[model samples]
Each structure stands twice: as C-alpha cells, then as structure tokens.
Target: MRPLQAKIIADLHVQPVIDPESEIRRSVDFLKHYLQHNPQYRSYVIAISGGQDSTLAGKLAKIAITELNAHHTLNYQLIAVRQPYGEQIDAVDATAALDFIQPDQTVTTNIKSSTDAMTLALRDSGLIVNDLSRGSIKPKMRMIAQYAVAREYDGIVIGTDHAAEAFAGFFTKYGDGGTDINPLWRLNKRQGRDMLRTLEAPKTLYEKIPTADLEDDHPQLPDEMALGVSYDYIDDYLEGKNVPNKASEKIEQLYLTSAHKRHEPVTIYDTWFY
Candidate 1:
C-alpha cells in the first residue's frame, strides 16, 4: 500500500486487536465523562436508522446516561430520534432497533414534508436537483431535526461515523456527518458488528446488508455495490490486512477522491483551495 494510505489507516487506529467489551466500556465512559464535564447538556441525542452503527451508538448512549442517572446527582437521558423521510421503507428494521435501545425517550421527525417542500420550492424557482443530490438533502434534514431536539433538551448530537465510513468518506458532509460526538470513530464495519454482538443487539441489525438507502431510483442498493468496494475489503484495508492489488488500488483512489469530505469546508485560509 502507498505510504499515504498506510498513514490514513494508522491515524484511524484500526488495529487487528478486536476487544468489543473494552471498547464498549471505554466509549460509554467517554460519553459519561463528556456529559459530566459539560453539565449544561442534559442528554445525548442520536438518530437511529436501524443500522449497526446507530444501534451500537444508541446502546452506548443509553448505557452512559443510565449509569450517570443512577450514580450522579444530575439527571441525563439518551434521546433516540428517528428521522424518517416519509414512511421509512425499512420501518420494521428501525422499530426493532429502537426496541433494543430502549432509550429514555424517542422522537420521530418525518422529513418527507420538509424534504418535499425544499424540492418543490426549487422546482418553482426554475431549478431542480438530481436523485443523488436530493438524497443528500435527507441526511441534512435529519441532522436539522436532531439538532432541533438536542437544542430543545439541552443535549448533544451523537454521530455514528466510524473508521470505514470516514476513510471511504461515504457520509453526507454537514449532514449526518455533522455532530458533537462520535463513539465509533475508531471502529470499522466488522468491528462495529463485533461491538453489536457484545451489546447483544438484534442479530438482524448486523446481519442485513448495509445500504445508504439514499438513491430513490435504486432503492435499498447495497453500499458496497454503490461504492464499488465491499465493506469487507474496506474493513480489511483499514485493519492493515492484505487484499487483492486491484482492491487496494481502488480503495486508495477512493481515499484520495473523498479527501475533501474528511476535512472541514475550505476557506480563504486553506492554501490548497485557491
């Protein structure tokens, strides 16, 4: 692998050691500590989409706040927000995830009305957005909903981004990617599954194919097929495991092309931007 790519893996801390139990405790502790320090925040909020990343995160946040409530004077809650765009196509999966988390409270913000309004306004103004661009709007709308809840409750927004997604830059920038905390940043897809197993989350949550569920025309397309590199391949690459030459080259190229997503929006001070 190229040195730059190797450096990216190292920086993400995707090691071969798989310690789900320890990682869970560490993440829970991390959340508790952050909330304790920032006493102004009364809770941790996460948008659970019935995916492994969000499921694990919601579980951790619940554990953290539950522990804090029991032991500390201050009361905190883990608010699990379900931001469905119209009727979420995978409503069953999302329901199962919410049941498993059993968060202190749950909030559902149907983004369909908001998303449609934006699209309708755009068309009225003699402009239109393609499917891919329209899909990005959902995540941003979801984030807006999450922040609204967080602000209402004096809480923090927790993101589900992990090493594999971060390296692939598969997230919508300033959308689902915008958050105050991420407990799974060091983990990859496989590692996330291991954590879910440790948490005893519903097996189906991890077993089902992972999809961004973004593009309307292609509905429910697997992320690997969309990205042109399997999660196993991405996970292997992140974990420093050797893979086919073509896979490595393609993964490296993906890292290069998506570099912009990995960083903050460029401004005049960004020397590379001009």
Candidate 2:
C-alpha cells in the first residue's frame, strides 16, 4: 500500500481542521475536475441513503452546482436519488432524504425486484442459503437500480465513500463502491459529517447510525454490524484518542488486515522486465 493510504487507514482520526470555507473549495475543485474530465456525466446522480455520508455528499453536490455555475453558467442537473430496498429503515431514509434534497429533484425508486433477482441468482449458485441472508445481493441490486436511473436521466453516479470505508474496503467493489465521482473520498467520517453540518443537513441524517438499509429487521446489519465497530470507534482511534483496549486491538487488526484492499492488485508486470 502507498504510505499515505496506510497511514490514514492506521491512524487518521483527529480533530478536524475546522475550515468550512476550505472544505467548500476542496469539494468544488473535486467536482469540477470530475465533471470536466467526464463531460458525458454533466448531470449527477447521488445515491442518497440519508446517512451522514450521503447527505454530506448531496450537500457538496449542491455547492458544486452553484460553484460550477459561478465560474461559468452551465446547464447541468443534480439528482438526489433514494434507491430503497423496501426495508423500513430505507423507507424512513427515503422519506427524510426528500426533505433534505427535495424529491421533485430526487427520485425514490424501490429496488425490490432487483434484490429478488440477486437472491435467486445467489441461491442457484449455492452462495446464499436463504432469501433473508442475501448480503452481497442487495448492494449489487441497488447499484443496478441507481445506474438505470442515472442513465435514464443522463447523469453520472455520485457516492459518499469516506477514507475510513475506503481503507477498510467496506463497500462492495463495483456495487455501492462504483461511482463516476466521489466528493468525500479524502475526508474521514467525522469530516464528512462536519461538512454536512456546514451545509445545515437535516438533524435526523446527522444523528442516525450509518447503514445501507438492506433488510428491515437487519437495517443496521448491512453496514455497521459488518464493520465490527462503529465509525466513532474507528475515527477516535485514527485521531489518536485513547481507545478501550479491545477497540484499540480491533483497530490495529482492521488496519493490518485491510491494508491489501487499499492497494493495486499484485501482478507480474515486472515479469517481462525481470
């Protein structure tokens, strides 16, 4: 792994630099670069799950929209989408998300059919025992639905993958991890939340435990439970706070174990040279 990615994965939780203005500039630069490079993605489709991460990403997109226009008025669209899995947690998130970004601009699409297809495919492959335990199926289904929406609206997919999640590879590669642009890639969880607060995001989103809303009974299971620790613990350890012995140990283990996920695939590129 690159030293910076390793250092962040191991210890990046710290007090924020507290420059809201700087954050805005950073976000603007990121979005401008992405949109400029990917001109086909003039419109943006954000997978807003109403958690702090996505909420903050949505806020940043709004800021980027204006900032982009200020530099030169351009005709572009920002779509805040809620691809619900029909879970109660997701339903609530979808409802709350509309208030934050407004549904007229945000499309709430239920992806139960896609989720069902994934379960059936996994079951046939013997990778899944039953319908309810289809963990990997959900994110993939959600991605398909979001991308369909993005294509329908001629937009590019946007996501909120912060440094911590990226370090841990907490997201399903090419699923929720797939995006044309990510505004929060460099920011840690706390920094993402702080940016949302700067944009005055809804209190519900800010306070809610982060989850991907895969199952109603296991709304929190899809993400938080899988991580084996909350972002708070992860962030605190990264920031160099004194964590409980168990949490400290877990943090160290996670950083070590997930280090491979942060790097390029090991390859025989040197075979020809050798």
Candidate 3:
C-alpha cells in the first residue's frame, strides 16, 4: 500500500462513522419524524430482496411504524413487496425475510410481463437488444412496481442503498436506487451486517451472499463477481483503507463512471428568467 493511502486508511478506521445501537435509534427516530412531518405519506414501502441491506432497512422501518402507531393517532403501515422478474430461485430467502420483517402487508408483483413488453417494444423499434441492456430493465421494473404499491397505499418507497455499494455505484440508476427515503444510506456492508445482528435479523439473511438477481441468463451470479471486486476490498476502500492497486483503480473507475447514477436526471433549461 502507498504511504498516503495507508495514512488515510488509518485515519478513517480510527474513528468509525457508524455505531450499531446509535444508528438504530437514529434511523427509527428519523422514520417516525419523517412520516409525521409528511402527513400525506401514511405508510412505508420496501422491496424485500431477502438480502442483508433490505432486511435491515425493512426491519428498521417496521419498528418505526410500530412505534408511531403506538403513540400517534395516525396509522402507519410497513408494506414489504417481493418483486421477481419470473420465478425466483431464492424464494425461500425472500419468504424468510418477510417472516423476519413481519410487515403489515405483503405483496407479490411479477415484473416479467412488464419487462417483456418493454423488450418487445424496443425490438419492434428496430433496436437489437442485448442481454446486458435487457437485464437492466428488471431493476427499473421493480422500482415501478414498488412505486405502484406505494402510490396506492399513500406510502413512500424505502431504499437500502449504503456507502459500500454507493462507492462502486453498484446499483441500477433510478431503479433499485430510486426511493423516497433511505434509512440505511450511511451504513457500509460490514456495518449493515452488524446492525442486522443487533436487530436480531435471521441468521440466514446475514449469511447469504448479496446478488441483484437481475440477469436472466446468469441468475445466480453474485454481486462481487459481477463487479469484479469483492465487498471486503470495497468496504476497506470506503473506510479509507489502502487496498491493492488493482482493486483501488477498479473501484475508482466504477465510482467515477457511474457518478450519474447518484444524481437526478439532467434536463436542458427552456429559458432563463431574470
């Protein structure tokens, strides 16, 4: 490791940004306060992918909803929606996540039809769609499905995006990354696992490898394999650790190239008024 990178790593690790117990309290309070301030939103909607991030966020939202219901006259619901492109091979994990979250309502929305329709439309328009392009549709469709449920229930969609994945831009833009509220925005993958343990999340959820499950041809591909870098290195880099040169360069490239995913849509101004 270079001296500068090593020094940065040492500094970052010396003072951690996340504390499990405090983060839990702050997150739960943030959810409650956010809903209270935004009266129109009566529920919280989350896409439960049976991954550690989602499970942790969903469980935190559930706790906030329950606490709000107890002290306030307003009734808040935590709606966990399972969106599968087709038949989910890891259906058991999703089921287990729901069991642990115990959301107020559960909805299953299959996005295969919608994705197919979009692909067909594009094909009819004389565009040759490839596997990678086609696979990107799944996360966008999932976001659409989640918003549909949230709209119906007067809820805001909750996101599980965190520092580790955000560093690599390891999410579909305006897709799984699209959400109204993100309670787990600052936690890294390691910190997320710690939070899950603190919340007493099911062991299966924390133990399982993270995957986007978006590829139709290679559905079982893990996130690390897809990204060409492992979470350990990602987390270390995120914490300002000195990772190998190859890993560091790849991480920097991903973060730089995918910067657009972190921002809102860009639009040309029609006119400037003085």
Candidate 4:
C-alpha cells in the first residue's frame, strides 16, 4: 500500500479509539447530559427499521432513559417509530426489534401516502420520477415522520450513522442521516456488532444481512448488492487493513461524492453588503 492510502486506513480504524463498555457508558452519559442540559427535549425518538444499527441505538437510548429516570426526577423516554412505505416485507423483523428494545412508546406511520402525494405533485410539475428517485423517497419520508413525532413529543431524533456507513457515505442525506443526536457515530459496523453483543442485543440483529429495503419490486436485496461492495470489505478498509484496490477506489469515490451529505450546505456571505 502507498503511504497516503496506509495513513487514510489507519485514520479510519475505530478499535484503537473505542472500548465497547466505555463507549456504551459514554453514550448513555451523553444522552443523559444532553437531555438534562436541554430543557425542551423531553425524549429520544428513533426510527426503527429492524436494522442492527437502529436496533442497537434504540436499545442504548432506552437504557439511558431508564438510568436517568432512576437517578433523577426526569420523565425522559425513548420512542421507537416504524415508518413503512406500505406493507413492509420485513415487518416481522421490525416487530422482533420492538420486542427487544421495549421502548417507552411505539408509533407506526405509513409513509406511502406522503411519498405518493409528493411524487404526484412533482410529476404534475413536468418532472420524470424514476424508480431510484422513488426509492430514495422512503428514507426522506421516514425522516419527516420522525421529526413530526419529535416535534409533537418534544423529543430529539436519534440516528444510527456509524463509521462504517460514514466511511463509505452509505446513508441518505437529510434522511436516515439526519438526526439530532448520533450515539453510534464513531463506531464501525464491526464495532457496532461488538457493542450489540456486549449489550446482549438479540442474535437476530447481529446475524441478519443489512438491507435498505429500497427495491419495492424485490424487497430482499442486500445492501452490499446495491452498494456494489460488501460491508466486510468496507469495515476491513476502515480498520486499516489492506483491502482490494477496487474496494478501496470505490470507497474513496463514495466518500468524495457524499462529502456534501456530511456537511452543512455551503453559502457565500454578502461581505460587501455587511
């Protein structure tokens, strides 16, 4: 490996910077401190899609709320939300996740109506809507539902974006990637599984293949197939290992293109006017 590539890989490795137990404690503490300091935010809201990342984050949030309630006179809670576009094929996994997380409250919101309405409006405006664009609506609509619930309940949306996804920029901007707090932001996918194991998360969560459920016609497509790279490769690359050249190049391309998603919108200031 070249020196620059080796340095980038080393920089992305997470295990050197994370201890599962300590990370869990820090996440819990961070949640408690955030809620305590922010008087308006009364709860943590998580959009649970039955994925391991969301499941793990929701479980940790629940634990934090429980710990906070025991020590303080706070009524903080964790709200696990399920936003399916229609009848989700993986609804069973979502149900299982709910059972495991055991959130303080649950909300089911079907996003089909909202997405369909928006698509129709866009079509009426003389725009062509393709399958990929339609699929992208799911996460955006899910985020909308989550924020609506957060507003109603005075809660902050919790996100599951971690180092694995961040390294490849594998998340939707202003969608699943949008959240008020990201407790798992620093952990890689493998580290996330380690945390799940430490937290005693369900075996199903750690064992299931990750998917975005974007293919409406075929809902079972694995995320690796969609991204054209397996998470194992991504994780390995992020852990400072020598990955295949193709995988490394693809990762770099994704990271570069999605850089905009990871940052706030750029705007030029009116210096002369000021």
Report the number of the highest-lDDT candidate: 1
Candidate ranking under TM-score, highest first, comes to 1, 4, 3, 2
List the candidates ranked by lDDT, beginning with the highest.
1, 3, 4, 2
The sequence of per-residue lDDT tens digits that candidate 2 reaches over residues 160-266 is 77776875777766678777777777677777677667777777777777776555455466455777777787766555566677766665666667755555555
Model 3 Cα lDDT, one tens digit per residue, 1-274:
4544444334323225578898899899999999999998999999998889999999999999999999988788999999987788988999999999999999999999999999999999999878888878888999999999999999999999887787667888878888898888767788889889988888999989988877777887899999999998878776766789999888777766775676666557523211
lDDT pick, better of 1 and 3 = 1
Backbone clash tally (model 1): 0
> What are the per-residue Cα lDDT tens digits for candidate 1 across 162-222?
9988887889998999999999988999989999998888899999999989888988999
TM-score of 3: 0.91
For every model shown, the clashing-pair count is 0, 3, 0, 0
Per-residue alpha-carbon lDDT of candidate 4 for residues 1-274, written as tens digits (9 for 90 to 100): 5454555455444553467898889888988889989987889999998889999899889999999899887688899999988898878889989998999999998999999998899899998977778788878999999999999999999999887787666788888888899988768788888888898888888889998887567677888887788888877777677889998888777766666676676667523222
**What RMSD, rounded to one decimal, does every model reach?**
1.5, 4.1, 4.2, 3.4
Misplaced by over 4 Å in model 2 are 1-6, 9-16, 70-73, 102-104, 125-127, 130-133, 215-217, 222-224, 264-266, 270-274
Give me the overall lDDT of model 4: 0.83
Angstrom error of the Cα, residue 6, model 3: value is: 11
The runs of at least 3 residues in candidate 1 whose Cα sits more than 4 Å from the true structure, single-residue gaps closed, are 268-274
Q: Which pairs, if any, clash in model 4?
A: none
